[model samples]
Target: MGIRLSSVILIAASVGLLSNCSGIRLRQPLRSTEYDWRLFGGSETRTNAAPQFLEPPLKLVWSYDASAGFGPSALSAKDSVLFIATLQGELQVISIKDGERLGWVSLGSAIASAPVVDGTTVIVATADEKNNVISYDFSSARKYWKRTAGPVESAPLSVGRLIIIATLNGTLLALDRDTGEERWSIQVSQPIRSSPASDGERVFFGCDDGAVRGVNAITGNLLWTARTGAAVFANPIVIDSLVIVGSLDSTVYAFHVQSGEIAWKYRTSGMVYAPAAGFEHRAVVGTAHGDLLCLDTRTGRLLWSALGGDAGGVINAAPLIVGNIVYVGTLDKQLYALELSDGALRWQTELPGRMKTSPAVFGKRLFIPVENRIVLCYRSTSGEE
Candidate 1:
């Protein structure tokens, strides 16, 4: 199916504005402590890394009941508040310390991905039959503004003045964070189910068309595009100068950001959907066949593989690596904690439903959302649910 020509023209105009420069800049050095992780993957880059917390087998502080049904990942912000956009389309902000419902805004549409926050504004992309993006004030529970778009399956990313979103129609949009106005958009072939990434100067995302494209963070111009063997569904990760992304072709790729050249590609027995967790020269990840593998990021050489129990044939979430431990969830309804260095099993926790979302580790707890519609809090200590 082709995207509407009108939408194509709209995106082209916005990207053209990037040539003007003098748009937005981060004043101080970009710090992880400032922004709230309102989306499925964490941050605008979707790094999904929280260096503050030790890996799971930690401890569950508390678990709260979500007013709406399951969608994807829940939002964990900085103010000890957890924002959840339910399948029913209501946005709820809760106290992370106690799971208390602080406030809620009814969007009257289904939210597919986790909402992202910029300053006091919480932005949510609705997958309603109407297809719109809405912003709400986290502090006051008021509607900020709303704009129509294609079906947004990927999570939204916020840089400075621009909020980047990837849609199922195979386009990336840059919108004004303050006014909800269009800034620019870039078109790609195939659908975009994976979230986009930013490194202050460029935006990167993967698509079902078997390619990963990088665009100017300022101008929306295509900076580089790299081909993969199959579709990509996970958000890409940017660390230093390297861009790491995964593909359904059973491989994890490491690419050179500035040159658009392949650094390495690690193959697995099953399809891969989530980005790899990197620590210095090594990277760790899981496969759809239920095996967790650690590889050399520079050479794509496998270091170790731990065969997990037969739960299902696919792994959807990225592994969370903290210090010496790597945590991963499988379609088998199991969450496993393996040794990061050797892929040894430390402990495993089972939930009532299949596990598709990555675990959110904060403080000493792992916030795991199961497919059965229950948001579970597991203590890293005993691996108890």
Candidate 2:
């Protein structure tokens, strides 16, 4: 298949311009007591780390019925507001503090990718027959524009003044954040199901052809391409000068962001489909064989592997790191909180259904979306809350 582009005119309106295109800017300065999960992987880099410390013995804060089942789309939050997209073709805005439905709008298609929040605007990509990317103004409940980019299962990245999205047909489209106008587009050789990660200057993503690519965030020009052992299904995690990603060939590869040189590669026992979360000196990732491995961030050497009878389930969700603890969801319907230093199990909780969506953490609360239509909020009992 080839790349196809079309622009669909929706309700349009003028809005406040972004401060700059360097990256998404916060409406208010981030306070010490407030944290927002604004991107698919928590940020453009997709590290999936929470800013605050969250301890175990979590209490259920609230539960909201999604009406339709949740898919691979993760949740995004800003200023205590949660943005949830469902397979039922609905974009809902809810209160993070209490599960109240603040606002909602029908997108008219199934949404498998997470929505990105930039100030008062919400950007999302849909997977229905239209395969449209739409932006809306939350405050006014009006859509700024909608453009058909192709079939997109991957989440969109809102950086600077562009909304970057990759289609299943291997085309990466960069659209103007304010007008939804096409800025630039790049086509690869294979499908891109994994979400793209960015660091403002460049965007990184993996393809089904076993290639991890880097592109200029502004011009959509190819920067570098690194080949992996097998198809790359996990989102790339960009940290410092390296781009780290996992492949279905059971190996995790790290490439230099600038030169695309192989920094290190670690082989696992099973396919690595979930994205890796990084901390100080260690990176944590889960495998299909039900093992959680912690590796040296610089050397890719295995520091410790949490296996045996304790960790035996398929983990498709990326690990959530907060302080010294790592949280991961497994297909066995369990959520495990492990120590980041040694992968020791700190706590475990059973869920109502399989947990494939990564948990969203803010303040002292963790929001978990299950395969069922239920979204559960857990408040850390520790003094931090």
Candidate 3:
């Protein structure tokens, strides 16, 4: 069966079935190769920046079908490999250069979120029929450990030796990186959809209860909580002292990382599904109403906006900002390139189905996942310069 894209997000948030076991411990921060792009938006800063492709049209180089359901956002390493988790509980490692299938490993459960990798291990928080978190060693391709928690549709975040995640049951769990052991689990008033974001000393995450919360990363202590207008399904982006998150209320809210006070709120016509992409003084975000908007990061002022076809789609996935171009996909099954400076269309490509996963860019290659149960790799027609 195909993934229930529209119903999947809602069901994942309403069902909190926290039941399962798994084990790991890396106290002093296991010394592995640098996992530069660990979070949903690449870095904690969520810059979404990579070198630009030369001014040329892009073409599909190769395609890999997971043949299960939808795939999550593809993650890339400086080493030039793409990592992805599937709804069928499969993990795949592919070469970014030629889209060669390097390796495929099964974790034995459905993985709804992107896998976070650090050093030798790739941590995937999956939802079994029983609901639990499973950690694995990507290098050895072995099950390292597992931890029982509520249903996790959101991806887990790794900060040093700690992994932070949320559940539909209104529980926020902190797991030790090495041991897969629970650091702590804080109970919130309502269910959570926003994945956690870390700024070293503290963790910032969003919840469906219309609250954006901050918790102490080390002690799992509640730092502060601020309420928004409606459920918050989008992930928050942390830029130095500012925390940016979007809500179903059709608005983007920025808060002080320490005080949790509203720095500014930018209103949109439709629900904002992803965090704002910040570059220089501007931040870019897409609306469920099919409009791409750019706002000033400091004051939340509108810099520019562009309208696209509804395509019966929402901007659920975060956009990839390469140089001056912003790349994003829609339920319309179209990949769009917009000028970051003015929100103008650069080019658009059609895919077979809806694209729930964000684009992963490395050098000149763009790897995108479509709900048609296939992952595609495209390169600029002129090739990498």
Top of the candidates by lDDT = 2
| Candidate order (TM-score) | 2, 3, 1
lDDT of each: 0.68, 0.80, 0.71
Winner on lDDT between 1 and 3 is 3
**lDDT ranking, best first:** 2, 3, 1
Which of 1 and 2 is the better model by lDDT?
2
TM-score result, candidate 3: 0.86
Model 3 over residues 10-51: C-alpha lDDT tens digits? Answer: 001111122232212122232222334554667655556554
lDDT of 1: 0.68
The candidate that wins on TM-score is: 2
Q: What TM-score does model 1 achieve against the real structure?
A: 0.84
The candidate with the higher lDDT, 2 or 3, is: 2
Write the residue-wise lDDT of candidate 1 on 1-385 in tens digits.
Answer: 0111111000011122224211111122212343234555565656665544355455555666675565545455543456676777666655555665555556666776777766667788877535378876533435568787787867788888888888888878898988888889988878998788878788888999889888998889898989998888877887757788878888888888887899888778877776666665667777777777888766778899886456433567777765577777787777777777787787776767787766665444457777766666655454222
Q: Which digits, one per residue and each the tens of the lDDT, describe model 2 over residues 1-385?
A: 0111112112222333412111222233222224778878888888888656788867788999888876565598766667788888677767676887755666767888789887667888988546388886655545668898988888899879999989988899899999988999999889998899987899999999999999999999999999998999899888757898999999999899888999999989899888899878678889988888998878999999885245568988888898888988888998888888888888888988888877787767788999888889987876745
Candidate 1: the clashing residue pairs are 14-184, 18-219, 38-115, 57-380, 57-381, 58-380, 58-381, 59-379, 59-380, 60-379
User: How many steric clashes does model 2 contain?
Assistant: 2
Where does candidate 2 stray beyond 4 Å?
1-34, 129-131, 308-310
RMSD of 1: 10.7
